[model samples]
Structure formats: structure tokens, C-alpha cells
Target: MIHLERVNGDTIWDILKLTVADHQKNFVAGNDVSIIEAYIAITSNGYAFPFGIFEDDTPVGFVMIGYDKDEYWKDAPAIADGNYNLWRLMIDKAHQNKGYGRQAVELALRFIRSKHHFPLTM
Candidate 1:
């Protein structure tokens, strides 16, 4: 069963070990970087939720969601004023092309919806 697990001390190493394909390395940031960004965001008074994508007991990928009004996206664009952004989504190279990415996205969306009570744009 594919599900999302909170990225904590117990699971941080497993999430950090996940990586994308060589061709995708340029596009996706490493899990370590994402986790660092999450920490920064949280410390800056922004909302950041980082999760490990898992299939049963095995870690398969990572996803992060962020919500900020003026701290992170103040000058970016009008659409990002107060929306829940999918900051990161990464499936390890070995776990690619198996529908885990899609399932993980759906799970992330569901998670975002569950946390916020307002209308979501994405």
C-alpha cells in the first residue's frame, strides 16, 4: 500500500537515501536539500510539510508541501499569494515507472486538502 509518512528522525535517513535518475538530477533537488529547505521554511514562520512516500514498509519517494502568504512567495506571483504549493516530489530512480509517482501525488494532494479548510488552487 502506497502512503505518506512524516519525515522524522527515525525516517530521515531513509528519505535522504532516495535519488532520481542521472538525467533527472538537474531537474530535481536531492532529498537532503528539500529537507533543509523545509527546516528553513518552518523556522521562518512558513508552513512546510515533508513526507516520505512508502510502499508498505519500504521507502520509495519524497514529497513536500508548503504554504506561505508573504514569506516565501510574496514577490513571486499573484497566484501564489496563499496557496498550498507542491514544493517537491521525487521518486527514486529504481522506483520509477511503476505508478508510485502518480499515487504519491494523489496522496500528497489528499494530505494538503486534509490540512487546510479553505479552497485550494492545486
Candidate 2:
């Protein structure tokens, strides 16, 4: 099973470690304390909402979905006009294609819907 929940101050560490570790392995851009710190900084703000994706009890990946651009990293894309950005739609290598990414995306969408953030699905 897959699920997504908000990454508040309490849940940031696990997601940070998992995400940075994956980035260290898969991303040519590299991952480090500084990068993870940057993610933490954004999550501390109101403009971004980060979610942890889990398979059963273990974290599989994380996604930060929101509209603000100033909080993103230099490499991250700016959200389109009137559209929210779905950043870091990642599933761990061990869990990829088990449909977890879709589930996580759906959960994020549903949660967004509850907030009345998006009037139309894109």
C-alpha cells in the first residue's frame, strides 16, 4: 500500500535522510547536508507543502507540491502561471512501478482538493 502525509517539523528528518541518500546515489547533481538543509528551510515556510510517501510503514519517497517559486532550489522549475508545481515525484528504486507514485500523487491531489487549491485538474 502507498500513502502520503504532510511533512511537518516532526516528520522532516526521515524524509530528508531518505531523499538525500537517494539523491546521492541517483542524482548527478549530488546531495548533501546543505541540499537537505535547503529542503528543510522550505518546509519551514508556508509557501511549500512537502509530503512523505510510504509503502506500508516505510518511507519510499517524498514530493513537495505547491505554487510558490521563491522557495525552490536553483535547479527546480518555476510553477506555471496559475498552476501548482509537483516537485520530487520520486519512488525509491526498490519500490518503483509498484504504483506507489500514482497513489502518492492521488493522495496529494485529494488533499489539495480539500484545501480548494485547484479548481481544475491538469
Candidate 3:
């Protein structure tokens, strides 16, 4: 079964060993520290989140969610209020077609709802 879990600095660091070194579109390329830094930034702000999508406890993708357009912008009338936005989501190419992506996304949504501490769901 696939699962979604919150990412800490340690887990993010560990995943670097597997997230590939050539992905640059959304991930930091060439170095793992870039990933660590990105997650750290997210956690530090209290307004963003990142989740590790795991299949049978093994990581397969990264899903980033965050509260939108804060003070910098009017926080546009999102998909809905009290709902965060998915900033970037990527499944490791190796794991893309094995039905894990669907499971991973479902897992991510669950994690996000839990993180928000909301009893209501989508």
C-alpha cells in the first residue's frame, strides 16, 4: 500500500540519495542540500508544507503544498478557502507507471488534510 508522510529535515536529507541528481525543473539539481534548504524554508514559514509519498513505506514522490498569496498578495480566492495549494508534485520517473502515482496523490491529499487538522475532508 502507498502512504503519505510528513517530511522532516532528516527524511528529506535521506531522500536525496534517491531523488536523483539531474532533476532541475522543480528539484534542486546536482546537490541534495538544495532539497534540504527548500524543505527547511517551508517548515520555517508555518505556511507551507511538503510531503513524501511512499509506497509500502518506500518513498516514490514529493508533493509540496502551501498556503497561497499571503501578505505579498491578496491570497487569491483559492480553489476554496481554508484549502492549501499544491505547489509542485513530482513522482520519480522510475515509479511513475506502476499505479503508485495515483496512490501517492491520494496519500498526499490525506496527509494535507491531516496536517491542517481539519476534520472535514474533500
Which candidate leads in TM-score?
1
C-alpha positional error of residue 43 in candidate 1 after TM-score superposition, expressed in Å: 0.3
Give every collision pair in model 1: none
Off by over 4 Å in 2: 19-46, 71-79, 117-122
Please list the C-alpha lDDT of all candidates, in the order they appear.
Answer: 0.86, 0.61, 0.59
Please list all clashing residue pairs in model 2, or write none if there are none: none
If both were scored by lDDT, which would come out higher, candidate 1 or candidate 2? 1
Q: Model 3, range 86-108, lDDT digits (tens) per residue?
A: 65566666676788667766766
Per-residue alpha-carbon lDDT of model 2 for 1-122, expressed as tens digits? 77786666776676666643454565522223434544664575524566778777788877767554444445644344445666556665666767887888888887666665533233
How far does residue 75 in candidate 1 sit from its true spot (Å)?
5.0
Give lDDT tens digits, candidate 1, residues 35-99.
99898887777778899999999999999988754365456566655778888999999999999
TM-score of 1: 0.89
**Per-model RMSD to reference:** 3.4, 5.4, 5.0
Off by over 4 Å in 1: 69-75, 117-122
